[model samples]
Target chain A: MSSVRLLVGTRKGGFVLTSDGKRQDWKVEGPFFAGWEIYHMKGSPVDPDRIWASQSSGWSGQVLQRSDDGGKTWNVAGNKFLYEGEAGTHQWYDGTPHPWEFKRVWHLEPSLSCADTVYAGVEDAAMFKTTDGGTTWNELPGLRKHGTGKDWQPGAGGMCLHSIVIDPTDEQRMFIAISAAGAFRTDDGGGTWKPINKGLHSKYIPNPTAEVGHCVHHIAMHPSKPKTLFMQKHWDVMRTDDAGENWSKVSGNLPTDFGFVIDVHAHEPETIFVVPIKSDSEHFPMEGQLKVFRSKTGGNEWEPLSRGLPQKDCYVNVLRDAMSVDRMDECGIYFGTTGGQVYASPDGGENWQAIVRDLPAVLSVEVQTLP
Target chain B: MVRVELPAHLCRLAGVGHEVTVAVDASPVTIAAVLEVLEHDYPALEGTIREHETKQRRAWLRFFVCEEDWSHIGMDAVLPPAIVSGKQPLLVIGAIAGG
Candidate 1:
């Protein structure tokens, strides 16, 4: 029987949730680095014992932490992040030049093969890699220096590289998404890159169909199908067939497509999940009803999953990095909300339950299946 | 051993109680030497108080001894006699933000 561990990062701390194959009863483990905002925490798919965390605070700034014995003990990795060459500036929210600064790390993507290797996506928009575990980090400057560094502008949330997708079949190819900057691809393994936001359109930017400048919230791809991707943009649910070369709106019959997270099923690659908020201005669920919509056909059609969820007077919102899935015999889904509840669906979105109803507001959630 | 007091958050991060005793190994102990010892003894707080690359004090954090702000003072500068003799504990304070 396989077990599951949920690596949850919240506004105030980090928690480790463990359960047996049944996943009915769970044991909650911490607020490990209490009082700090745990932006993200992820376990290596190859080495289940290794974990990485991004911890930050308004007063203390940024820190990277790693754990070797699962979450039993953690060590602070190096936090010295410097640009490779001449650092430049990006456009501010009001279209004025703003010097590129390291605000905080948003995501950490460990390599599929080696637990010691990982990629960090940071705000002010840049990518960094750590080859010798998390002891040291080196920026892959080609990402920002490739071009478009100046024209890139910050979204209301600040310019951040929040998503990094590594092709399961090919290690040399990768995709990354930046808010207010659209999607980008690096087929040559971070040495060179190009924008892949051809079909994306945003009403917030001056040019709705420009080559860049789309507030992409999240992008997910089922490992089995590396080329196909699903995107939750500022106002639309989109799909790309040719690996982001082009995209098409699949908002379909969704009540309102303004969402922050999008995820694909573990077993069924075509099935996807999204939680549609009221709009950009109002970050609550639609009509004060909390629902998780599933699309079996990959887009254009969506069905609400609210059996074990609050549907009346429920006014919570799920952030971009707060939703995830587990790899098991029967697929399991999990998501956390700004309201501090972590809901789990052990049976693939049919019946849901709150794993931990109270914690600090969750910032991110990730799952690991143990053999 | 030099007596030191950390803020609540740093105390929890170092897995210690409100105040901690640091082993200052250098002769004529200085603030920089004290911080180096703290970082070396507590791996979890490698760069929490000062920058690892530049070794500069974090902007929002201040160093104090006996109610005097020592944050702007040079790191290599020797501490007051009371702090060096352990009569007064060195305090690492996180400046209060927006009231």
Candidate 2:
């Protein structure tokens, strides 16, 4: 009997949802990193013993922390990069001087091939790679070449680099998505990158393909099929089977295409999950109805699964890192929203239940089944 | 020198009713000095501002100078000129946590 656990990350801390094989009863523990804006957290897919988290201190700045012994203890890595720096140390390329300034690491992932290898997607829209377990890091060559440099324009939430997906079977193949830069992939590790935004729609652009505003909020990959992927684009939901060579809209059944997070089943390559929100208006759910849509046959179809959800009017926006699928065979699906509520689906969205309510805006969710 | 007004939560801890003034001669005042005065005048506020075990700033508290948020400012960095000149009050805000 394999057990399952859900690790949820929020603006103030993180929570662990534990369940028996039955998935009926659940136990929630903690506000881990209590009081920090934990954007992302995950136990290494390759090595479950190691865990990493990206936390931002509204004004204190951001820090990347790692835990080797699960979530019991944590340690910070590298020199803290400030948004502003002293006379000679280093300053934000933009020269925006301040008392303390540093780049905020919005997402962190451990490499699939090297346990010590780590990657961080920063708020400055840059990617940093570490080979020695985050002791030191270097910006990727491809991003450096783009040289948007100091003038890297930030979107509504700043120039955020949110998602990085590495083909687990082939470590050299990687996909990275920036908020306003669409999506890019490199077959040769970070040596080269090409924008794969052929079919994505950008509300800010008359021609979404040729413009840089086709922002990608998140990306999900089928565990068994490396070439198949799903992305929550700024204005649409997209699917690509040729490793992002092209994309097609797959949100026909959804109420609205504007959402931040998407997830794929850990074992079922065809199964996927998404949270839908209204577009153009206030960015809330359509008619204030919060629903989690799942497509068991890839993105060809979708079904709203909210059996145990609230029946009253509810408006909430789930962040990019707030929804996730656990590592269990059945794979419990979990998500949190800006309204400070968390809902879980034990049977991969066949049914839903609220685990906790009124917590703080949930920023991210990660699930790891403990050994 | 700029006067800083603490929120009710912090003010109660500091035991001062109105505001506490700190002398800052530079343009950008360091967070460390502001915290030092806050701790000196109302020692109880120090432990609340930072974690007791690690001594790091608490995640729920934020600092501001005028309309600009100073939470990202370095602990040892200087306060900006506008804040030192009393054009803005160094404001401390407590972030709301929980769902």
Per-residue lDDT over B6-95 for candidate 1, one digit per residue giving the tens place of the 0 to 100 score: 888877777888877888978778889998888888876766788766788878889897898888888988887888888989998889
* TM-score of chain A by itself in each prediction: 0.99, 0.89
What's the i-RMS for candidate 1 in angstroms? 1.9
Name the runs in model 2 displaced over 4 angstroms.
Answer: A79-102, A147-152, B1-99
- The CAPRI category of model 1 is medium
**What's each prediction's clash count?**
0, 25
- How high is the DockQ of candidate 1? 0.54
lDDT of 2 by residue, A1-371 (tens): 66666667777777766777666777877777676677788777677768887765643455566778766777765524322222122123343522212357888878876788988888666677888886666777565344333323445666678888999788888888886667888888877777777888775754656634466889989758889889998778899999999899888777788888899988888888887878745767777677888888788588987787765588778888888777666778888888888887877777787788878788887777654
Q: Can you give the DockQ of every candidate in the order shown? A: 0.54, 0.06
Displacement of residue A296 (Cα, Å) in model 1 is 0.7
Q: Which stretches of candidate 1 lie over 4 Å from their true place?
A: B21-30, B73-78
The weakest ten consecutive residues by lDDT in model 1 chain A span A78-87
TM-score of chain B of each: 0.93, 0.76
